[model samples]
Target: MLLSDARSIGRVALPLYLSMVAVSLGALVNTAALGRYGTEALAAFAVTTAVYFPATAAVAGAVRGVMPFVAAKADDPPELLRVVRNGTWLAVFVGVPAALAVAGAGVIARAGGVPAATVAQLGPFPLLMAAAMLVGGFGSTATSCLVGLGRSKVVMRAGLAGAASTAVLSPLLVWKLGLNGAGIALCTANLVSCLITVSGLRGRLPGRLGRTIHFGQIRELAKVGIPMAGTVLVKFAVLGVLTVAAARVSTTAVAAHNIATGLAGLTFTAAVAIGQAVVPLVSTRTEGVRRAVIAGLTITVATLAAICAVIVLGGAERLFTDDPEVRAAVAGLLALLVVVVLADGLQAVLGFGLAGLKRTTPSFVIFSGCYGVLAVIAVPAAQHGLTGLWAALAAANLAVAVGQGLAFRRASNL
Candidate 1:
């Protein structure tokens, strides 16, 4: 049964994994390109990304909460169509506020105590990314619906298209326009991806187009999604706070932190692919929770272990930047990521498993409480320097992973 479950998950996860890798590569390329401009530009990009990702996560997470519901009715074409329609509405509902929040990036950066010079260099970068978020939210909804319907290949293709566009356009824009060029490239790529994914959905699931927004369905989605959104928001908010603390330290620390984070994101996406694979299987199969969780953990452990080995053996620091100081700093942070990535992988699988069961509130509560405590500890730790900050983050991931693992055990038993 375990082997069978693993195979099933692998089938779904492989394309998703490749797609995520492509997207992560695009981010890595962006970071590398931005690094050429200067440390100030890199730091500004990091700060803006820290702010932008959380807001987008909140909106995306809420819309993704529709997946389990959609999967449960996968055999019913009409019902699935209705769920997709309502989920689109939910995307718009959450995305507007998130876009507004992102538009105020300059104010937020200042309040976070980012250096004035870095802030000045940021320009219209934040506003452009905010627009991307609005379009990306719809893309996320369509992608989640396809995942729920076991059509992950469509999502994979869309992600690849976006990544390719970003990879080609970001450097050109940055070379021509500086920091703002990166933003323009991101917005254009997001719009293109959203159109592709949504169009694919229209082709695959043609149906009546005149249904009005159903508050009952919206409420149903929110009942599950709001907690999921809260979970995602809490996790990213912790990182945002840490980014602010890093800014307080020095531009060098911020640059090192972003580089390490970009590397860690590659491993994190592998975990996400496994979790996403588990979601539909858990929703559709009876008595599948235990096997699904085990498969997810197994794949996550293997994937991250391989990544850690490469980083340790290959001296992968040169892939991002050439600065001796930044490379040295990244080395220490990478050591911490060896543990953090495993813990993060475990928590992602467990949290998504709980969501598949429609038991998302526990994840929200556990992550919020664990990360809140980490936030309090991180402020003083940042004063000590970058190593201290990395240690604090590592501890936070461990705590959340343990908490969510235990919660999953209890939820599965129920």
Candidate 2:
């Protein structure tokens, strides 16, 4: 029965998995090109990308919470639109301030002690990244509505379109125009992607003045989003410390680290997609089927991780970059990272499993400790060097997987 159900789960998960893989691979392509450029460019992206991640990830998660909830009400467009409309307002309320804050931070960092060249690249990049994220936020909510209605294929198509644009644009921008151009390309690519994704939804785009703001849902999104945002913020803290640590080591070290991280991220995306796809199904399934849902998800994540491990272990140098020393370092990191990646997959599965059960708050609490506290501690302590960074990451991933797995088991018991 579990095997049969797993097949069903795989059928739904495959497209989403492929989409994530494509996106991750595109990032790898971007990273490889950037790694070739030299340390300053790499460090600049590392800091900026870390800064951008939380904003995008939070908005994405908030929209994600809507999928299963909205799915159940597929027959009710008015209700769905109302909910989506609420989400859009939240995007503006939250996103605008976030854009300004990041851009402002870049300005302040320039004033503080950062090099002039780094400062020049930093200021405009955050605004572009933020604008991309804000537009992407709306797209995320719209995509959730479509997914809830069983239109995941539409989501897949839109994502592929976006990834295609990014894949083509990133290198061209970097090669021709330098760092600012790269940032501009990223923003443009994401904006195009969001537009394509949102167009897949059934509802009309609310005009800039369609409905007065719904203070209630705005508050609720903030209530949910703030904690979710906290999770992302904490992640940024860890990345920030790590980036600073890498910079102190040397710009080249930071660049190498970025390539290694990007490669691992590419492999990890398969697991993330499976975990995400698991949520709506698990949410809809009965208690009797919940275990089966989880079982399918775990299997999907494990299988994907194994495949990535084989590929990376086999071709770490070629896949990551051409420099022998950088390759050696990255391969060692990837070797350790495969274990971490496996654990991360499990963690994602368990975290989203909890989310599927309408148990986000507990997942949030667990993640806060796992990701926010323990994971945060590991990175800096890894100041032993690149190897140390891997060790730190491994410990962080293992802890989160075990902790979240225990939480899921307990939650399932109730």
Candidate 3:
């Protein structure tokens, strides 16, 4: 029964999984490119992205509130257009401030005690990321809308295009312009993604799309999106703190931390894709939701384990960098990184399952409380280097994973 149900869910999840993994692989390549550029360049990339990713995620999550509504209204073209319009407006309302904030995050990097030299080399990376944020908001909304309408393959195709751009651009640009070139490469890649997804979305809508802002629908999108955004924001905010803490340790520490977590993100996205694909399926069958979540957890664990095993056996850590110190530092933290990735993957599926049920409030409450604890302990944990810091992070994820599992069971009676 579970195997049958897993195959059913995989139909929707496979495309999402492929798309996200492709994007992450592009990022991994970007990381490798910047790593070769030198430790200072790598540190600059870490500092800026620490700020960029979370802020953009919050905006994207906020905009995605329209997806379920879009799905519900899919057969009704008029209402679907309205949802799309409001979702677009929400994208702008949230995207603009985020861009401005990211543009100024060099200050935050300084305040966070990143070395003056690393902070000095930031250049136009922040500005480029700011532009990416604007495009990202729309890309996220368009992708979500397409997924809601069962056009996930369109999203996948768009992602592959972006990934291809990143692979080609990161090396060429970074080699010429330093890490700032990385910024341009990343921005262009996101632009490519945005254009494609928006184009796909355009084909799906039949009538003339108006540029009118509907406050009522914006409020509805916010009602669901904000709490969901809050959940994503707090989680990223905590990681941002860790980035700062790693910076305090050494450039090598921060860079190694980034590589480890970046790889973990590759695995975490598998669960993220499953959780997303399961959302529309969630309302239809309670038992099916349970089966999907279980299948998702199993897949997430196996994927991470396999990736980690390959990294260990193949001595492929060299693929990320030539810095022996950085490689050694990451090597010591591998077990903890595995724990953190597993816990995060498990909780993500459960938390997203609750979100699918339109029960996002508890997730916000649970993450806030648990991660709040991690925030408190971050400084002390960093005193022990990456090992201690990751241990604390792993503990927090486990607590949140347990909390989310209980919540999912209570909400769905699964």
Candidate 4:
């Protein structure tokens, strides 16, 4: 049974992992391009991107919520289209405001302290990135829906196309048009990805050009989506506080933080992809089977975390920086966060499992307590300064994972 479940997870998760890795690299391409332009450009990009994370994550959850629904509707094309179109409408509606909010926030970020010139330079970045990602959101939704339907190949193809385009275009744009030009290039890639995803999804999802978009489905999506939005906001709040604290530590510390975060994000992308695969599977499985499934996923997550720890702790400095102290500090920080990653994997897999069971409210509550509140409280309270921040993250992740794990086990029994 364990072997069977593991095989199933692998079948679903491996392609998802590949796609996520490509997406992470695409982000790196953007970072690399901005870095080549100079520190100011990179700094501007970091601030703006970090600021955008919460909104995007929250809005993106709507799409995440749709995955299992689409997966369950695999045999019913019209149902799939119903979910997809609702997601499309929701993306368009939410994306515009999200862009405006992020743009406004960027303006305030500059007003508050960031540099006048840097702020001016950052002006177009938020909207452009948001717009691009808005398009990417549609593609992501489509891909995720496809994955839910056991169509992982389509997701992988779409992601590879986007990553390839971003890698090629980002540098070219940076060379010709500078940092803002790179943003434009990214937007183009996202639009291309959206097109690819839509094409791939053709004949899979129901509803042709004639079907009117359903307001009721959008409302139903919102019922689930609003809480997820809150969860995203909590995450944003936590990161925002931490980013501010890191900036106060030193500019070098901020840079180190960003590098470590990017590395960690790669791990998370894997977790999310795997967790996404778990959602539909768990939703459809028996309780005993679900427990076994979660166990397998937890082990896989731990293994991946260990691997990430070795790579980052072993040699990330070689790739990311030259400063010995920053290297040491960053390595130690990443090592601590690797434990968090382990816990995060467990939480992620089980969290989505719970969501698949329609038990998302508890998850929202648990995550809020663990990440939102506990994280905020613990990070600043750490005695070791920056290391304290890492400790806080580790504690939060472990706490959340343990809490969720217990809940999942008990719920499965019930």
Candidate 5:
């Protein structure tokens, strides 16, 4: 049964995992491209993305509100189409405002307390990020449709397409247009993913796509997704604070933090992919959900530990930057990241496990209450420099791990 559960989990997770890796690879490639551009540009990319990622993630979380329902309707094409149509509409409704927010991320980031110089250097970056955010939000909705229907290979293909675009475009664009070129690369990649996934989703629909949107289905998806978005918002809000703390230390520290985070994010996606797989499994296979979650946890831990070893021992950090100062600055941050990444992976799976049980409300309550209190420590830690700030982030991620893990127990039981 354990093996079967693991296989089931893997069947669902592998494509999802690869897709996330491809997506993350795009960002890392952009980082490498910008790193060669200059330190100031890299620092601006770091801060702009710090805000951009969280905003897009929040919107993605809200779009995920449709997954459990889509899974429930998987056998019924008409109903599934209804669910997904509403979801895409939901994506459009929320995504527009989120893009606007991303467009002004420099000012918002300034308010969030990143160094003003970093913010000032963010010319044309906010607009580019907003463009990526808008396109990516819709792509996330389409990807969720595939995930719910066990069509994750389509998602993988879309992600590879996006990553390929990034690989080909980032160098050319950055070489020609610098920072704005990076943003254009990201936006174009998202557009490719959006087109491919939406095309895949179309084949599953029994009839022509709707001309009119339905508010009721949108509300239904929002009901599940909103609190989850809140949970994600709170967690990343702490990350944003940590960015401020790093910014306070020095531009070098903030840039290093972004590099470490990019590395960690690549591994963290494995765990999150497991959680995304868990949602439909737990929602459908009531008895097997427990085994699925356990198997996912095991898979996540082993995968991350291996990734940590490979990154640390194999000299992969050089791939992220050509800058010696940035490389040296990032080395210390990597040690601290080993612990933070594992803790984050644990919390992410548990949070997704909760989502599987359709119990996202507790997730929001726990994250908001826990992270809100713990995030304040980042301010004081900034005074002590990079190590102190990372430790504060570790504490916050650890506390969230515990809170969300405990919530999963109670939620799964109920």
Candidate 6:
């Protein structure tokens, strides 16, 4: 049973992982393109991205809530079409407000004490990214439905197309129109990807579109989606607080923290892929979540181990920056990340499994209530500086992992 579960997960996870890597690489390409414009440009890009990603994640997560529903009805073509149509409407409902909110990025950045010149250079970036997110939200709905239907190849292909377009367009746009061009490139890629994915869905499903707007289905989606969005928002809040804490330590600490975070994010891609795979399987199959969770943990640990090994053996510090202080700080943070990643990986699988079972509220409440409150306290209370911040983060992740695991066990009666 364990072996069977592992194979089943791998079949979905491998393609998802590749797609995720492509997406991450696309972001890197954008950053690299902006980096060519100098420090202020890079800083502006970073600020906008920090402001933009959480808003998009919230909407995208909510739209992705359609996955389990679609997976449960995978064998029913009409039901899948209805759900997909409703999911698209839900995305628009959530996305418009999100886009409007993110349009205030300049105001937020100014209030956050970003330099006026950088803020000025950041003009239209927020709006451009907001547009991208709106389009990407629709694409997320399509991708989720496809994944739930066990058609991850479509998602993978769309992601690859987006990544390829971003890689080519970002640098060209940045070269032509400066920092704002990156935003344009992003929007272009997102729109292209959305078109491709939606087209794929049409080809696969082969049916007329259902009602464009369905309040009942929208409400049902929101019932599952709101908590899912809350989960993402809580996690983002924790990271934001931690970033603030690290900033207070010093500029060097902030640089180190970012590098470590980037590396940790790469490792987390595997965990997320595993979690995504687990969702559709758990939604369709009965039992085996225990084995699935264990398998996910094993994969996460092994991936992190390889990353840690490379950091130690391959002088991974040079890959990020050349500063000695930053390198030293990143090394210390990576040590703490060994614990953080494990906890996060465990929680992800359990959380997604519970999400599959439509038992997301418990996971949301426990994560936000426990991790959120502790992270708020731990960041400010950590007297030992950056180490204290890392400790706080690790503790928060551990609490959530344990809490979510217990919650899932009780909910599942396993």
Best by lDDT: 1
Summarize candidate 5's per-residue lDDT along 101-137 as a digit string, tens digits: 8898888878878898888888987898898898899
Model 2 misplaced stretches (Cα beyond 4 Å): 25-47, 121-126, 167-184, 203-214, 218-225, 242-257, 372-389
Which one wins by lDDT: 1 or 6? 1
Model 1 stretches astray by more than 4 angstroms = 28-50, 110-127, 174-181, 243-256, 321-329, 332-335, 380-389
Runs of candidate 5 exceeding 4 Å displacement: 34-50, 105-128, 177-180, 246-259, 315-336, 381-388
Clashing pairs in 6: none
Ranking according to TM-score, highest score first: 6, 4, 1, 5, 3, 2
RMSD of each: 3.0, 3.9, 3.4, 2.7, 3.4, 1.9
Higher-ranked by lDDT: 2 or 3: 3
TM-score of each: 0.88, 0.82, 0.85, 0.89, 0.86, 0.94
lDDT for predicted candidate 3 compared with the true structure = 0.84
Model 1 scores what on Cα lDDT? Answer: 0.85
Estimate the overall C-alpha local distance difference test score of candidate 6.
0.82
lDDT of 6 by residue, 292-346 (tens): 6666667666766776677667777779898999998887776787788778888
Per model, how many backbone clashes are there? 0, 0, 0, 0, 0, 0
Q: Clash number for model 5?
A: 0
lDDT (0-100) at residue 116 of candidate 5? Answer: 84
| Candidate 4 lDDT, 261-321, residue by residue in tens | 7677667766777777776776666655475455557656665766686776478755888
In candidate 3, residue 142 scores what lDDT?
A: 94
Best by TM-score: 6
